[model samples]
Target: MKKFSFLAAPLLLISSLAGAQEGVPSPAPTPAPASQKEEAQTQLVVLETAMGNITLALETERAPVTAANFLRYADEDRFDGTVFYRAMSVDWGEQPNGLLQGGTQNDPKRILDPIAHEPTSETGLSHTKGAISMARMEPGTATGDFSIMLGDQTGLDANPDGETEDVRAGYAVFGHVVDGMDVVRAIFASPTDPYKGEGWMKGQMLADPVEIIDVRRIDSPEGDEAEPAPKETNSAEAP
Candidate 1:
């Protein structure tokens, strides 16, 4: 069993090909073609980080609850002065394979109540390259912390039949980076302090956290007006 560590606060921690039906010669029913409107059904939000901007296309239709929660934070200016403070690097798979985490970091004033977990099993989203997923301590404890994948981490996807809760109920991937992966890589490559953080997160804390200047919704769905830019503020504390 592949392990995935996407946790909140204390910690942060599938390409599965379906088997062909046996002896079934009947052709499978073709799926209906997606309309132009359906194809363009996504909410775009940009995180203007100190390093650079990272654009995200949230799967609002498929993962509504998770997407809405993130939007609420952005719309209310909760993440304005937050920083990308953790870079979990691993020497496996691709060269820059791991995750970069940032968010409210459980600031009582900035964070909202935890939302329901939306597993890949239900959302049909995978932890592919540039995928953005929530960071929770348990299956249903995710709040404002999130991570951006650096490579195709299919190992993070839910395994419905797995033996453990962590595998059966995987992390919720609500969106993906549509642009500025180079910025993501650069932040991941930034200096990390060897003596910071707790437990498994030790040595993963960024020596100098990259500030998130602003987070704004650049575009909205049909019939929705774009939200005003978030006011600048600073209230987050380093972990």
Candidate 2:
């Protein structure tokens, strides 16, 4: 198990300048024709961690609400200073498959209200490698936390209860991890253990905590124009 020193200071900081207003969802630009949707779904997001920087392009078409929610948090700066917190890698005979989870700490005001679950039926987004999804104990319980599956995670998308004709629908998948998957794999390989007797842990935890440092939205070219810059003034020298 590789151990990363828990350095409080971040090695790099990537600033996302988009501004998000409360109670106002970011507008979805006009939808592209069917042919263009595939190419247009990609969104770039940079994750500046204590270890290194990881970039991701979220799949908006696959998971609109999930993408919106994530962007909302970034716009609000809710994830600033949060930690990666959870990482797991399954080592079976086959290639390792697991996920990395992170989110805003248990801050009441910062947590966004839960959004409705959009499983494959609604979004057609499968739990494939590099996918990003919300981390919730059960349906309708997701708040600020989210996770990115390192490999196929079809099991997490179905419902656990058999009452529904559909398979056990689990967590709601929102986006995909298009880049920096290596960083995720590294986090999964970090040393971890069950947080003995801790709340919500149920005895499962990461011994060496991975901190998030901060999370902010990557501004689009248009959004970047909205920022206010320092005023430049010319001074005259006395004759």
TM-score of each: 0.78, 0.67
Model 2's TM-score against the true structure: 0.67
lDDT of 1 by residue, 110-159 (tens): 87777998987777777788999887755777778888999866656666
Per-residue lDDT of 49 in model 1: 95
What is the C-alpha local distance difference test score of candidate 1? 0.72
Clash-forming residue pairs, model 1: 5-13, 6-12, 6-13, 7-12, 7-13, 7-136, 8-136, 8-137
Off by over 4 Å in 2: 1-37, 159-168, 194-203, 219-239
Model 1, 17: alpha-carbon shift in Å? Answer: 34
lDDT of each: 0.72, 0.54
Identify the candidate with maximal lDDT.
1
